[model samples]
Each structure stands twice: as C-alpha cells, then as structure tokens.
Target: MESMNESNLTALAAFNHNEALTKIPTFLFLVLLTPFGIIGNAGVIYVYGCRLKKTNLQHFITLLAVFDIVCCLVAFPLKMVELWLPVMYPSGNLCKVQNSIICFTCVASALTLLIISVDRYKKVCRPTQSQMTLCHAKILFSVITVISLIYSVTAAFIYDRRSIPLDSDGYLVGYTCVMDFNSVVTQGYFLALFVVLVIVLGTMLVLYCLVWKEAKKHFMQSDLRYRHSENQEDGEDHTSPHKRNLHRTNRTVVLISLLFAISFVPSLLVSVLFAQFTHVQFSMTTRTIRELIYGTWALNSSMNPLVYGFCNENFRTEFQNLRIPFGCYGRYPAPKKNDIKSIAQV
Candidate 1:
C-alpha cells in the first residue's frame, strides 16, 4: 500500500513537470510579446491617428492596432498569470474579464479585416462605384464594437473557475479558468464562433481573389501603355508608382489575412475538438498542441506593425522617422486633394 501511494505521487509529480514544460512556449510568448505588442501597436496608432490625415484606410488600420493593444495589455497578462498560478488566479471575475477581452479583440479584428477587404475590393475592382468614406468607416467601427461587445459579454458568462485534479485521489488539486464542457450551450457557443470565423475568412478570401484578378488585369494594361509610350525617357517607366503602391497595399492585406488565419485556425480547431468531443480523453500531446496554438495569438498581435512597416511605403517612412529619444516629431505629409483622388482611383 505504501509503494502504491509512492508510485501515485511519483506519477503526479511527473505529470506536473510535463505540464509545466508544456507551458514554457506560452510563457515565452507572453514575456517576449507584451512589450513589443504594446510599443508597436502604440506606434501604429500614433502614426495613423495623430500623424496622417483621416481616411478610411487609416481608420481601419488604427482600429486593428487598437484591438492588438487590448490583447497585449489585457488578455496576454491575464493569460500569463493564469498559466503561472493556475491554482491561484485571483478570482472568477478576472478570468471572465480576460476571456471577454480576448473574445472582443478576436471578433473586432476579424470584422475589421473583413471590412478592409470590402473597402479594398470596391476601390480596386470597381473604380466607378462609391468608395467607403470616413463617415462610413466610423459607422462600421461603432457597429463592430457593439457587436463584439455583445458576443464578448456572452463569453464572460460562459467561463468560470474549475478545479483540476492533480492526483488520482483528488487530494492535490489546482484551480483554473474553464468553461463547462458538459453544457450543451457552451459547446454550441463555441460552434457558433467557429462558424462565424469560417464565414468571415471565406468572404475575405473571395473578395481578395476578385480584387487580385482585377488588379492584375489593370497592371498589365498599364504596363503595355507605358511600354509603348512615346514620351518614355531613358528607358524608365515613371507611371509605375500607382501600380507599386497598389501591389504593396494588396500585399499588406494578404499578409494580415494570412497571419490571422494561421494564428486563429489552430486555436479554434482545438477549441472545437475539445467542445465537440468532451467524452474523448485528451492526451498530453493534444494539450501541448493546444497550448502552442494559443501562444500564436500573441505573435499575431505583435506582427501587424511589422507587416505594415514592410509592405506600405507611407508606414515605413513614418516608422523610420519615429525617433523616440530626441522628442522630435516626424510629420507625415498630408496627401493633397488631387493625390487623394488619384489614390482612390487606384
């Protein structure tokens, strides 16, 4: 009997060690990502919100940065605490708030991406159609905030503190934030979130496909015209700025979408599996996979500024001149009315 008890304790200790090892990735992400996310997103917000002229594109990009900031400041810290002290995370209210903020950021970011795709499609594919204006962007932002808030509140209600058994005898235990797996409503909520994500991603994919097709056709015609132009000087094609900018914008959108897909798909898939197959005992491998996927969220939030800096010339210029130490402000030149109009046509 003593040997049996010793063996059980040994097994529990090994399991605890493994669990701690599995959390290392998440901890590293949170530690490395928090500062970068906060600073990078803050820079984006500063450039778009304070430096540039107010445009639909600026608004949407700023909003995305805002969501990323919330994830970094609120969600990431709570997650780190939860992982570090799985047994003693203050209270259920904190967990609820953390989950709520996570939900809000995810929902808001996805919807904003969808809206940006629609806006890009309209501008690139249908030049004669009405483009999204600043007013329209404001309306859409408010709508998304309200919609996201509603869903997030629902998430807050869905999660609570749950006890985790650390031994076969249930003598050693830990508390963690979790939802009711046995509840049909909880499972259904997760299923609904998954369905919504799929639909949003699908719609964005279609819009981008059409936009790319149109942009390619437009670029080919422009290239042909430039090649045959009588005023071509020194074998230089000067009419390619619009095409370059257009391609850069397209690349930025693609990168953001790809990041979102890579970050969210695995996490959501694991969530769906756990929700739908509650009866199935998840092995250590599965749990480790889930933790790794969850860690990707921080990477996703931290990467958008890099994407913007690398893909957009305007953003790159601003970022280059963003000297923090000297307190000298870098000014982004406001586009002239004609330049704005020409950009809109592109």
Candidate 2:
C-alpha cells in the first residue's frame, strides 16, 4: 500500500484488496468446470423437463434445472472470462453484468428449493391441504422471476470494472472487476440478501420438521398394519407396494435435503459476513477455503440429477430407458403416462 492522490489511492486500494484472491485455485477450478456444468445441467433439464407432464413438483424441479442452466450458460461463463482475461476495461462493465446474473440465478434457486420443500411438507404432513396445481406453480415462478430480477438489479448499480492507477502521476495500467462496496446502497442491498437467506433457511427448517414428524407417524401406522397383517400370512414380506414407494420417496427426499444443507449453508453464512464485514483481512488460504466451500453451490446444480438417479427408483428406471446413441441399447420398458406422473408426484 502506498500513499497517492485521493482518486489513485482509492482505485489502487481496491485493486490490491482483491489481488490476494487471485492466488486461490478454487475459483479457477470452478471456472474450468463451466463447460461441464452447462452440458450436464442442460442434459438434466432435457431429460426431466421434456418427458414430465405439467405438475407442480415437476415444474419446480424443471425450474431448478433451468436456474442451473442459466448459471452454467450465462453466469459461470462470464466469470470464467473475467478470471482468464489479463486486463479488463472499466468500460466493459464486467462486474455488474456478471454478478447480476449470479445474484439472479443463486437467489432464484434458493427460493425454488424452499418452494419444493414447502410442497413436500404439504403433501406429507397436511394431505388435507389444497394441492399445488400447475397454475399455482406458474404464478410462483412468475413472482420469483420478478423478485430475482428486481433484487439482482442492485448488482448492476454496485459493481464495476474498476481501473487501477499505477503511480503518483496516475499512469493508466490494468483494471479489475470488483464490487463498489463504498456505496451505501451496495451494503444495504447485501443486508437485504442476508435477510432473504434467513427467511429461506427458516422455512426449510420448519418444513423439514413437519415432514419428519409426519414420516414418523406414518411409519408407526405402517408398522402396526404390517404386524396385524402378518398373523394372516406365514413368512410373507409384509411391506406393501405403496409403502415401498413412499419409503423410496422419503429416502430420496432425505438425501437431497442433506445435500442442500451441506451446499448452501456455508455460502449463505459467507454472504452475510461479506455484507457486514467488508474490510476483513484476506489470506490466500482463507479465501481459498471460502471459495471451495461456496463453490459447492455450483457443484450442487450438476449433482442434483445424479443424486436423483442414484437415490430414486423411478429416476433409475427412466435413466435406463434413455435412448442410447446409434440405438445400441436393447429393449426398454416404456413407462406408462400414469407411471411417470406417479413418480413425479413422489
């Protein structure tokens, strides 16, 4: 750090502030995965979105894939270019444009996950409650779209491709994309985002508790039924088909929920820290750890389809039926429309 003209000092301070961050490899690793995530998440959207009929759950899942697609295609690539370029011009508006997409996709995905959990809670714990319809899903989607757009609009105002001056004479040199945290508006915007995270996480926690309680009650009733029916049949597997389906669905949901918590909690916490403590010291190792933890969000997007396929029976069945290139696959079971809908509902 060196003393210089006010304007030069301001820009140089910002440059060196983020300079140590470049030493972190986690950011670059994600940059490299941009292509893989785009391809994989797009494939997920195609497989799930194209075949599934209009249903609330399917709509929400498809929306998740869509958000992941946008992040991989739009946000991640922009970030990749920013990291790769040796020098960016302030005129390019890199930070604002790229971060705007980041804010939109990340917040939209979080809200969508909250919606999915709420839908599940309703179905599991409050079966008498009115079911979510396709139209309702559409309205929810529209609201989130508008909300994310409005929230992310702040990014465009708060970030910039800042030019760094080299010497006291203010010779032009290189520039970097950074958030203009000096603005009161930027801090306020981030504080708002922190509140949003708290609300989403709280909703998820409440829904999870309700679902768990309902699952326990169902398990007890199912055990009683099985015990009562066992006296009629000798050495029969008392588990019914419907119970098996519910068990499978519950297992899948539990796995996804655990993964969601693993991926997003750290990111949300770091975001709050950034909002409240912008001037905190940064080391290569510390920032690297943060990047690695937060990068789970990106990994989660592509991992979702795989998690579903591995944990859910229906997804495995559908995946097996997926057409192979050049028709190398043998005969496949074509699930009936009702069967697919049942799986989607699960």
Candidate 3:
C-alpha cells in the first residue's frame, strides 16, 4: 500500500492558479509585441533584401533581418501560445521543437552580430585587408549559420515532455516541457552558451575600441589641419571618401551593438544566474521583471529597422519611396546597374 502511495505522489502534482495568474501580464505583453516585431522585421527584409541593391554589408544586414523575422514570426509566437494556452500545445516532442526554434534564432542572431563586428573591424581598422566581396560574405554567413545550428542542437535534445498529476489519485492532469539543469550534460550546454557569448562580446568590444580610437585620431588631425589653415576654401571637402565611409559604418555598428547589449544582456545574465545557482529562488516580482526583460529583448527586433532609418540616409530615402504591397525597387545610388553595393561596409 505504501509503495502504491509513493508511486501516486510521483505521478501527480497540483497546478497552481496563483502562478498562472502571475504570468498573465507577460503573456499580454507578448501578444501586443508579436505583431509589431513581425511587421518591423518584415519591412527590414523587404527593404534591405529586395528594394535596395545590396552591398556585401547590406547582404549581411538582410540576413540578420531574416533571422529576426523568424524570431518574430515563428519563435515568439509559439512561445506566446505555450504561455497563453498551454493546453493547446500537444504533448511529446512538440514543446522541445518549439524551444529549439526559439533558441536557434537567438543563437543565430548573436552569431550574425559577431560576424558584423568582424566585418567592420576588418574594414575600419585594416582598410587594405582584402575586401569581403559578396561571395566571401555569402560563404562567411553560411559558415556561421551552420555553426549556430549546431550550437542550438543541445536545446532541442535537452528537454522532454513531462506529465504531472494534479491530485493525490495519480491522475495526470497537466503536461510541461522540462529540462534537467542539474544534469552534467545540460549544464555543459549552458556553460558552452555562456562562454561563447562572453568571448564574442569581448572580441567585439576590443575591435570596436580599436576602430574608434583610430577614427578619433583621424578626426582630431583633420580638425587641427582645418584650424591651422587661415584661408581654407569654403567649398572644398578635404575628408576622403574612404574615411567618410569608414566613419559612417562605424557609427552604425556602434549604435546597433549598444542597442543589442542593453536589451539582451540583462535577461541573459539573469538566466545565467538561475542556471548556475540552483539554490537561488525568485519571487513574483523577480519573475515579473524577467518577463519584462524578455519582452524588451523581443522588442529589440522591431527597433532595428528604426536604427537603420536613423543612421542611414539612403535607407531613409528608399523607405520613404516604398510602395505598400507593391514590389518597386528603391533608388540605390551605387554604380551597379541593378544591385547597388553600399560604399560603406555595414
């Protein structure tokens, strides 16, 4: 009789109304965020990929937009469904699959950003380094995509569909997706993720600093020369095209990096905290804050197009001319007859 009672306890767990209620606002935020993110990333894709004649850098940005669109269109929507109406989620591997897609997009997006940083570093810091032509960009992009996919496989395989009973009778009344954080294999995966992020961000930061220092020195010298010249020609533009392009590209990269760091780093740190410290407990407020952080992170995708518009004059002009539901290519002003490669690397 005692053995049967122990088995029953293992099979059944009560669903908590209070916890579900606590998640209400998070679900609501996701509901409102999903549509905007989809539209924003879609606009970015169509504008950058189709309307503009893409440079190698533009091609990279377009790919980033594609990943962000996937996040908005598929990953987060599935997550929202899971949170809002979990009963609708079929049992078995479906939940794991859903998480895999979400995690994949996140990893891909980060890797894409890492690529962008490397591209910029090469262009700005070593102008004579062989330029990344469209072909090279394609190869690099493909390599990173494959790497990110491989990294994301752990997320797919780590989780299992679990059923918990809601009462003492051992009746399974609820199902969930669960991963064992305590398991060595799962923690290894988490460690890999944490370490990769740290390495990528650190390298990006170092490269950015070097680029910025070079740019600042160049600018200061230019200013000094201007000041020394008493009779400078009013119409003369002394700044070289190469330098101007470098400056503009650096500005864009820095802005995007700052935006990404601000939006995602907090949530990522919190996640690391939870994973590393099993004894740590979260209160209702802490969970709520976590949801808000995640929502803001999702909202980051919507904000990228705006960043492009704010930083790139050409993008703004082309976006202005975009026709709703019409496939008109915008006027991109490079020498290429059909595909205008941007002068500045993104």
Best by lDDT: 1
- Backbone clashes for every candidate come to 0, 0, 2
TM-scores of the models, in the order given: 0.85, 0.79, 0.79
Which parts of model 2 have CA positions greater than 4 angstroms off? Answer: 1-24, 86-91, 165-172, 226-238, 251-261, 271-281, 320-334, 338-342
Which residue window of length 10 is worst by lDDT in model 2? 324-333
lDDT of each: 0.79, 0.69, 0.68
- From the highest lDDT down, the ranking of the candidates is 1, 2, 3
Candidate 3 lDDT at 109 equals 67
Model 1 backbone overlap count: 0
Give stretches of model 1 more than 4 Å off.
Answer: 1-18, 230-239, 276-286, 323-346
Number of the candidate with higher TM-score, 1 or 3: 1
- Can you give the lDDT of residue 76 in candidate 1? 91
Better of 1 and 2 by TM-score: 1
Give the per-residue lDDT digits (tens) of candidate 1, residues 39-149.
899888877776666778778888999999989998898898777665545689889998888888888888999999998999899999889888899999999999899
Error of 1 at 15 (Å): 7.3
Using TM-score, rank the candidates from best to worst: 1, 3, 2
